[model samples]
Structures are given as C-alpha cells and as structure tokens.
Target: MKPFTESMLNQCRKYMFNFFDYLPTKYQASARDWQVRKFVWAFKDGKCAVSAAQLVAKKIREQFGTSASDMVFVCIPASSQRKNEIRYREFSEEVARLSGAVNGYSHITVEGERLAIHESKSGKHVNDVQVINFDKEFFKDKKVLVFDDVITRGYSYARFACHLESFGASVIGGMFLAKTLFV
Candidate 1:
C-alpha cells in the first residue's frame, strides 16, 4: 500500500514518493523487487549508476509530472566523499540530466566517513560522524527532492531533511526507487 507521507516518523512530515514495494531479504522478494535489487547491487558497485539513474529519472518524470521541474534533486550521500563520488555523485548527475530537474549534488558536500548503519553490528546514527557543508543562502526558499536507491526504515531521509531545513531549504519530498517491506 502506498502511504501519502513516506516518513513514518511524525517529526519529519516530508512528502515522499517510492516506485516499488520490495520485500526484505528475509522474505522472498517479488519479481519486480528482485529486478530492482539487481540494479541496486550494480549501482552500489559503481557499475551501473548512470544507467540505473536513467531509469529512475524516467520514473521520476512519470511520477513527478510538472512539479519536478521546480525542485532540485539530491542523492543520499554514501559513507564518505570517496564512496559518494563513486556512487551518488555520478548517479545524481545523470538523474538530473535525464529527469530535467536541477542538480543539487554540488549544493551539499560531505566530509568524514560514518559507520555504515546497514552493515554495522553496533548501533550508530548517520549524523554522528557525518559533516555536511552547504551554503545556507543557496538553499534558502528552495525546494529539494531527496533521492535514494531504496528506503528501509527512512532514518536517513528524515535526518537529511532536517539537515537541509536547518540550512533554510524546504525539503519538499523524497524519491526512492523502492521501499523494503518487512513482511
């Protein structure tokens, strides 16, 4: 079922759009989910960020309609500058090019590495080790769409939205290729 607001956390009332519902690994994912997972792995490996982003861009264009033209799109940053460069930097660029949305990749810069919460055995929050720098004036009164390959729990989107808001940007929504289903 599609929920109107993607962030279950009430504090983050950002609008979010997801293209697919995917079952978690614990459960057998749907065929469509598996297809997306293949691309997600390829994207994470830096092998198909552009191609996969193109598909995402097409979907964004289809779903977002005219509103996308008014918003800037930023990808969720990887663990470090190096990883982000390998993954999302190029991905976001291609998405911007294909989707015709303003590229917000350069607007936010990340320094330092954080523990990968998805891979971690110990508990850690993404913001603890992340240093995100941006020109406050650039985001002032701007609308931003946060893009990610997938959303599991959405802590990242919520925190990132809060961060952008701190700098005066209105995080209008989030866009993800897929959202994981627990069952």
Candidate 2:
C-alpha cells in the first residue's frame, strides 16, 4: 500500500476539524488548536504512525494467516451524546472508505448508554441510547481493527481491545488517523 499522502492527511484533518466544529464554541478552540498541532507533527513525520500500524498488522497476518470471520472497526464515542452520534456515523463512513474492497465485514457504532454507560445523580429518568447491535456469530473468530480519530492517552483503545478479547475475537490491529504526539 502507498504511504498516506498529504491529500489523505488533509482529508483526515478536514473530518477531524468538522468534528471539532460540532463541539460547543467555548470548547472548540483549544481542541481545534491541539488537533492542528498534532496534525502538523504527524504531517512532518510522513505517515509514520499509520505506516507503523500497517506494517505491524501485515507482519501479524503473515505470521498467522487471516481468519474467515469478519472485521469490526470500533470507534469511541464523544462525551456529548449529540457529538458522539455524529462522530460515530462519520467514523463509520471513513472506515468504509479506508477499508475499501475488503469483504466479510461491516460497521458498528460504539456510543453512550450502550457501550460506555455513565450515571449521574441528576438523572432519574435518563433514557438509554441503543446505538448498534451485533450477533455473536459475526464476530466469532474474527479480526477487529479498532479505529479512532485521535489516540492521546490510549485508555479508550485499551478498554476496547480488552472487551473484544473477552468476546473471543482477536484484535489483530489498531489504526488511528491522527494522534497527539506533543502538547
């Protein structure tokens, strides 16, 4: 596969930026600036993060041939329910584009009230949000590539991997379009 190009990075940035814009105006500036700086560093590094992930995944596949079971690309949900819904959908679209031509897989949304449940004392009637559901058969013996927009602390990814492993699926790889390497 060709290394990620400036155009690809720019496209990714566009999506990330759009996501940032969806945030409340008060919260968007610092987050946007932070993402820009991260993108600059990642751009200068010339696909180093993505390339490393691809290389590592390829090696693992070569060592242990891929399974017939389908893949599930997992994306973490934002704290805000509205933003989480939007990002989850956008992340699904992006995954479809990035994994083009690959068969035997589908998209699943990970979001609030289902995947990541939070309880607050203020809520006695908090509605449960049903995001997406998958049958166990679909993921059995499958290889999952968890996708996230930016991975800074990595706790989210780690928790996701652990959950998949618990389900008897192999987390063969992880792909992040961008990451915060500096401040």
Candidate 3:
C-alpha cells in the first residue's frame, strides 16, 4: 500500500479507521496503467470490478471479521450529467452486495459546472461547497465505508466523510479503485 501523505491523513481526521488504498493509477514512469483503466471500464462493461470487490471483501473480513457487519457501503454520487451517461449506482451496489455489507442511503448531488473537474489532471479545481451537497438524514448513528472510483486530491472523500459525520454517522474509512499521484 502507498503511504498516506500528511495532507490525506489530516483530511481524514473524522474517520475512525485507516483508509484502504488498493491500487496505484500510474507506474514509476508516470504512465496510466492498464489495471486502473480496466478497473474503471469494469464499471461499464468488464467483470474486473466484481473481482476487485471480492478481494476487498476478503481483506475486510481478514482485518475486521464480524465487525464488518456494522458498516454500510456508499459511493460518491456522480454528477447528474454523468449519471445520464453511465450508471454508477450499479458499480457501488455491486461492491456492497459482494462485500456482504449494507448499502447505505445516498443523497449526495453535484452541480453541472463541477463536472469538468473530473476531466482535469489534478482534480483540485473543485472545492467542497461547489462540488456536493448532503442530505441531513439517512445516516444517523451508522458506520459508513465511502467508495469512489479514484482519489486524486481527496477533497471529495474528506467532504463526504465530514458530511456523514455531521448527520451522526461514523465514517469508518474510505475505499477507492485506484489512487492517483496528482495534486
């Protein structure tokens, strides 16, 4: 596993458990790796995501065992425009189902203007307030494991965890398919 930078650790103060970083998005030569791209495509067509989820489940079971039962899996919702193009709910739900965890309620929504940030190299152009909004309910006193396709700067994960905590939910940790070596 890649070590968490001080910035990432700082942003994750609200979480009770260490964030799991499963894969690297690039190699030492700074090229996009096939595994990362294939994992992303798995959300749309390939079966790699299922395998990845199963691996994650195995890891969680080994580390936490029956304690995994209390955790609910949730994804960072894609923007409305992206949702029209690709259904991310399937990716997240499938992970939850395979992991044997409860899929938590999600009310996160993004604005249209923020969609461009996903195409940007660093994903630092978007701020917390401009990117997403959270529902006041749906996660009271629950334990959540937030999942996302990638982690560039970790802004989204930080904000999502904070929002969930504000609603009385305990953010156990976060999971991502890959971690980018970008700002």
Number of the predicted model whose TM-score against the real structure is largest: 1
For candidate 2, give the lDDT: 0.45
User: lDDT (CA) for every model shown?
Assistant: 0.77, 0.45, 0.61
Candidate 1 regions exceeding 4 Å error are 1-13, 28-33, 122-128
Please identify which of the two predictions, 1 or 2, would achieve the higher lDDT against the true structure: 1
TM-score of 2: 0.45
Worst 10 residues of 2 by lDDT: 15-24
Query: Given candidate 2, what's the lDDT at residue 182?
Result: 38
* Each model's backbone clash number: 0, 0, 0
> Largest lDDT belongs to which candidate?
1
lDDT of 1 at 111: 91
Candidate ordering by TM-score (highest first):
1, 3, 2
Please provide, for model 2 over 63-86, each residue's C-alpha lDDT reduced to its tens digit, 9 standing for 90 to 100. 334431245555554444554454
Worst ten-residue run, lDDT, model 3? Answer: 14-23
**Please, what is the TM-score per model?**
0.80, 0.45, 0.66
TM-score of model 1 vs. true structure: 0.80
